[model samples]
Target: MIIEIKIPTPGESITEVELGKWLVDDGSIVSKNEEVAEIESDKATLTLVAPETGKISFKVEEGVTVAVGELACTIDTDAAGEVALDPPVAAQPKAEPETIKTEASTEKTSSADQRRIKTTAVAREIMEEHHLSVDDIIQGLQRIGKKEVEAVINQPTSTQKMESAPKNLFSRDESREKMSMLRRKLSQRLVAVKNETAMLTTFNEVDMSPIMEIRKQFQNKFIEKHGLKLGFMSFFTKAVATAMQFHPAINSMIDGEEILTPQFVDVGIAVQTPKGLMVPIVRNAESKSIPAIELEIKELAEKARSKKISVEELTGGTFTITNGGTFGSLLSTPIINPPQSAILGMHNIVDRPMAVDGQVVIRPMMYLALSYDHRIIDGKDSVGFLVKVKSLLEKPQLLLTDGKLPEELLLEL
Candidate 1:
């Protein structure tokens, strides 16, 4: 019996997906539930597995967009697996292992085809200096260069000796790859955000000494208490959540001349995955504890990287936080994630000289950049929101120490 493999609906918003690549060749036997092809959707990449043990045949070519539930391939469940082995030859008897040569090539040195080469200007000059014929270098190169000319000049000009040795052209290896559907989607969205939004970025630096000191002191205890490693993400998420309440514009979205604001803050974390950049939201992030926030972030990031995160989790973000610091980037202007008016960019921390009580001292410092939609959020609010985040991060004990935010930190919205 032949089993039909159909595309499963990845999501409601995703009606179609591109067949990224076929992992197995046509008529190759595969086991049940074995991954046979990869499906690329707008949100992420998904695997298409063999439905039953069988020989598989592709019904659709790669990179073709097909609607949900459309036929992708077919598997022949009745077919047995084929085992291919090389043809055997008679063995040489009484031969020692080291004295025996395995085989001789059918295409010998004299049988090789000479390659045609295009000579460049520099090659011509070198060829003139070496007083060699064009054919001298043609057999060894596709494009003539000084090296090829030099090679030709060093070889013997005897026709008999030249005929005995067939020279091979130096070939450059290259590969061509088609872009994945997710990458195409990423490109389109990034360009759309750049053209459609009146984006502006504000920059500031924070002394990370306080946060680092706290982490160094209580990191073991914090992990023992929470069962999770103390990370800067939780701190930033908390800070951004607290900061968003004070500056509502940073959390608001512009929808066709209407400003849409959410009462709760849903922070989108930009997670880098093999698929591409994915922003998974932690819903109601404003209310979650630091430990809860960290765990959810860990789960979402792992899911995103594994391409198991749902489309729902990737959507509806109120604000985004992207840390280029993970890649050791000192500074970068992150573009705003659309619908969400602002995105905070975090950078690498470095020990730098800072002023403390009118005295210069070395402190751990990190640069923060907030890119916002200028059409909706004014410069003042953007700067104010970033400042609030900076202060919270610098003095995190005010919020993260006991899970209680001091009343003074809350700006009445």
Candidate 2:
């Protein structure tokens, strides 16, 4: 009745993976198909689920590398009901009304008061022993004395404390951790990209007022209809996809002396997770509506962060988009994801004075950086591609017509 669980292969090339962590403790009852632990491969993080409802036992410790198909744990289906459960609430004594009221009042105290109060270790222990808080002790105090006022006056100011504090306290302490396979692989790929490719970055800026206005005006309707809010990434994603039509070379990659241009645009969105950065592709982005792109990006980003995304979801991207704007990066030349000829980097928006119709106008603007393999893509292609993206983003309506004006498409010009 014991079922042995083996490590699942994350990908074709991943021979081994590090045991990321266990979701449940050993000897705990797990439901059938319940995720028990996560395995970290160089490409992605994958979860191991229980084959059947059972009490599980761990065979390997977390953070240890194990070969694919190696035994990870075992679940004894026969011992499913052996684990004890907590007693019913009725079996325990109920709290008295006064005690419950006091606890409730303590919980209702303002968070600022909770943070502002400082207590000695001994005083904190006594307060805990009597189920008391700073507020409760304050309420019980008979009166404040001259000594207390003196104590308050003598307290060191934050600036004084900072100046007096030792500079090297805990500074010499150091610790090291083994790099996860994913990070190691990422490091190798980054180095390979710098050394192997003739990479060049071109930059451009876009006025975000039009897109921001659209979002502000239609966000409610968009959310009501699509069940998701309008976001900048979707607009940019659609813009990049639409812009690719005008500059197809930006979507092409060099493949062993042959230039491979994919007919479809699978735009990989770079999602940062606790483990590492993962690029989950939005398949055929050029053809999808903005709502659809937003929904898919949401799902893929959620999956990537939760470590539930598959290797297939992370692969086969023709181009990649990374938004450093979310983290407040003003500008950065993003490195290209391998096999993809170009990557678009979106940076933080800033309100600056811009020249408009012979008048100085304040406008919200964002910097865009496109890094490409110069050996395959020329400066003209790179610059044109970026300018096209900027135009599409600035005039979001152009996305609907595949980077052309509605009149242009109607006129067949």
Candidate 3:
């Protein structure tokens, strides 16, 4: 039976999405839940899975926008998987791979198709100065004329190449593809996050000595007991939760005339996935233990990478913490995740000289940035929230003594 695969409603407010690309080829047999195509929405790129194991056929081309509930493709569960491998029988001439040689060899090569060389202005000028046609460069590079070959001809060259005027980077006869739909959408959201919000950033530096000491003291024991490494996220998460208690505005969102304050803290941990940036929520973070927090983080991170995180996982987060330090970013003002009043940005830790006692000593330190909506959260509240988090991280023993145990925090664990 022919099964119609429809485009799913990406989200509540999002009604249409671009069919980015097809992963499986037409007539290929696909398994149940195997990703067949990718859909790009305003929020995130979602992979459409095969609903049933079957032979697949493409109904819509890539880079086309389809509305929600429209037929995207078809699956024939009963039809046997077969693909036509033979070329057309009536083909005039057989062009073998070895027979495909450039006519530029001992012959004046020209195309009536009007191929203009598209390259950097400098490269174009140099190409012109050399009196070199794109065909000359392609033959020199041992590549057939293609658009990318054109780009290679257009690539920036050193003075030596300009002087020589006889070399090419690659074949200049290939065409290039447009940017993926997901990339375009991602760029749009990032710009929107910057312009649409009353964005303001505050910075603070925290001494990592206390947490380093704690990790050195208990990391082995903690890892042995829980099968998960003790990490800084738990401490940071707990600290943010504690701070939210004293300064609730950091966890509040501005809705025109009304300020909506979340009673419980659903901290969104920003996990960089192969798909894109996914912020999975750590629900009721105020009550979660260190081990429980770490485990949940690990699970969410795995889900994020595998693209198994549900739409629900990405929703209703009161606050967000993004550690750009993982990617070696020294400092960044992370835009507030919309509807969330604030976000915490963590940076790389490095040993730096500081005046501790009477002498300058090297201590590990990290810069923290808190970006907030200036509309709802006052500067005092935002700064105070970050200060509270910094204090808890710098003196984790206080948290260890006062924080809830695993049994109290996570019921499953």
Indicate which candidate wins on lDDT: 2
Stronger candidate by TM-score (1 vs 2):
2
TM-score of 3: 0.71
Rank the candidate models, highest lDDT first: 2, 1, 3
Please say which candidate is ahead in TM-score: 2 or 3: 2
Write the residue-wise lDDT of candidate 1 on 137-185 in tens digits: 5645544555567776777658868677565678687899888888888
TM-score top scorer: 2
What is the alpha-carbon lDDT of model 3 when measured against the actual structure? Answer: 0.76
Q: Report the C-alpha lDDT of model 3 over 21-51, residue by residue, as the tens digit.
A: 8976687666667788888776567788988
TM-score of each: 0.73, 0.81, 0.71
Clashing pairs in 1: none
Q: Using TM-score as the measure, what is the rank order of every candidate, best first?
A: 2, 1, 3
For each candidate in the order shown, give its overall lDDT on alpha carbons: 0.80, 0.83, 0.76
lDDT of 2 by residue, 1-413 (tens): 99999998888777889998897767766778778898998888888999898778999999999999999999998886553222233642344322223545653432234344433333434444555444554533322222333444566879999889577655668799888889999999999999999999999999999999999999999989999889999988898888888899999998887999998899999999999999999999989998999999999999999888999899889999999999999999999999898999999999999999999999999999999999999999999999998888888877777777888888999
lDDT of 2: 0.83
